[model samples]
Target: MEKKELQYIHSFEEYVNEFINALIAYSPKLISAIFILIIGLYGIRLINRMVKKIMLKNEFDPTLSRFLASSLLWALRLLLFITVISRLGIESSSFVAILGAAGLAVGLSLQGSLSNFAGGVLIILFKPFRVGDSIEAQGVAGTVNEIQIFTTKLLTSNNQTIFIPNGILSNGIIINYSLQGVRRADLVFSLSYDTNIKTAKDIVMKVMTNHPKVLKNPLPAVSVKNLTDTSIVLAIQPWAKNADFSSMSSDILEQCKDAFDKAGVSIQPYTIEASK
Candidate 1:
């Protein structure tokens, strides 16, 4: 019994000594890993700031700049974490392999989400449209409210909010109404054949020219478009700023109607013919 107790004490002492030696050997590496992590984090922040400044200087879109900075910062932090693990004597190859496997699994599960993210990246880079621009795409017409990673928010003219997936938006044809500062308002007005065409055209042109919103450079135009059985179709085209297009169109229509009524001009009412 005495010999057995001595052997146990001797084993315990050796184990303790080995643990202490290992701890001492690893302590400096642990400190170095921590120090590197701190410095790496600081460096990442500095790089992010610098990148943002450069992007701003280059007139990059604000949304794209923010997204790029965040992505870069996270990637750098991930690399720093892997480096710290390696410094602590962890096998980096297995760790990286595990990360790869996990990423693959996640990507497989969220294929649609990944596609949307890629689409968002493409949109930010290409700049098909910008926030506050009026756009028509995917069968919806609205002003771009926000551009997100997976979806875009649109505020429709009828005050409806739509969330369209970036994947579909990026692939579809986008009609940006606000890209051009000015837009042409094409309106067709019908007058009875008995009314003088020259007088009607003069009246329409005068109304358009007098309007505050209409642009004088292009010169508003009114011309006879077509002759029908009961009426003459006049095509009235006026140019106005995109922002004022809707209101200007409405105002012109109202003013034209009032002017024609006061001037004793008759507007023809359409009567659909029954199918023969």
Candidate 2:
């Protein structure tokens, strides 16, 4: 029994020596890996800051710049991790394969998200609309507040905030109202059938020309669009800056009404009847 106990003690001591030697042999590699990790993290931060500065200097869009910076940082950190693993005598090819498999699984599971990300990339590259541009698309109209990786934010004219998925927006037709800097205000009015078409047109043209916000170079147009049974449909088209479109149109409407009344032009009236 004593001999057996001594043999067991001897085996335990040998195991301990082996473990210690192995630890001693790998200690330098472990320390180097840790050092590389620390320095690599610091370097990533420095690179991120430098990239931000360069983007800002180049006048890159803020949303695109932020997205690019974060993506680059993560990619660099991933490369650093692979380097550290390789330095620790681990096969990096297997690690990369494992990462690729995981990425594929995640991508498959989040296909919609990936599509939105791709759509955002396309939008940033193509620039159909920019921040602050008034746009109508996807059955919604609003000013573009922000363009994000997966979604876009819009501030509606009625003071509502809307988040539209980038995938849908990119695929749809975008109507950028502010892109041309100027827009046409189309106004229609009904005059009594007895009213002289030429006189009514002259009144509308004068009002449009006298308006301070209306553009004269395009030459405001007033024409008889239709002859209804009870009235003559007159169409007034005026050009104005996009920013002043609403107010200019409203002013023209009010001014035309006042001028029509003063000029003795009869306006068509609407009457409703109750069913018997």
Candidate 3:
């Protein structure tokens, strides 16, 4: 019985010794893995900050800056992840290939988005329109609020917000209303056939010329455009600042009405057809 008890104690001692050694050997590797993870995250943070600082210092466009910063952070994180995995005795080539293949599949799935992204790059480089500019593109007319990689946001005059794809906007013809700094308020006024055409033209021209908002450099004019059986058509063409278009248009209409009344000019009414 004594010999059996001594042999049992010896076996237990050996087992404990082996277990402790194994633990001691694994502790360094576990600590190393933890360190790698912590360092990788720290590097990512550092890279993100650096990229932000660089973008801010360069004064890049807000949209572009954000996009580039995000891309940079992802790229740095990928590199760090690869490094950490390599340190853990893992072959990174297969992992990289798998990531590449996955990326390709996703890219194929988002072809339209990729096209818009390409279009957005061109837009940023060429700068066809800027923020706050009133533009007509892709059948939408409004003031540009923001330009992004996939779309552009606009706020219309009626307080409606619209989003247009960047691909369509870039490819289509964009009519920038605010580019010229000035616009023409083209209006047509008709009068009865009995009214003196020359007298009405003179009165309208005088009113437009005296208006303060009307630009004098382009030389405003009022001329007879067409003569129908019942009325004579006159075109009032006046150039004014873009910001003053609406107010000037209103003023011109009111002034013309007052002038015509004072001059005893008669406005023609629409003729109604009688049943046969």
Please tell me which predicted candidate would have the highest lDDT against the true structure: 1
TM-score for predicted model 1 compared with the true structure = 0.82
**Candidate 2 ranges with C-alpha deviation above 4 Å:** 1-25, 269-276
Worst ten in a row by lDDT for model 3: 267-276
Q: Compared with the true structure, what per-residue lDDT tens digits does model 2 show for residues 18-44?
A: 999999999999999999999999999
lDDT (Cα, tens digit) per residue for candidate 3, span 22-69: 889877766786798898888788878888888889887767677677
Clashing pairs in 2: none
Q: Give all candidates' CA lDDT scores.
A: 0.89, 0.89, 0.82
In model 3, the runs with Cα more than 4 Å from the true position are: 1-90, 268-276
Q: Is candidate 1 or candidate 2 better by TM-score?
A: 2
Worst 10 residues of 1 by lDDT: 267-276
- Those runs of model 1 whose alpha carbons end farther than 4 Å from true positions after fitting are 1-26, 225-231, 268-276
Number of clashes recorded per candidate:
0, 0, 0
- What order do you get sorting by TM-score, best first? 2, 1, 3
TM-score of each: 0.82, 0.84, 0.73
lDDT score for residue 205 of model 2: 88
What digit string (tens of lDDT, one per residue) describes model 1 on residues 99-204? 9999999999999999999999998899999999988999889999999999999999889999999998899899998898788887878899889998998899
Report the lDDT of model 3 for residue 212: 97
TM-score pick, better of 1 and 3? 1
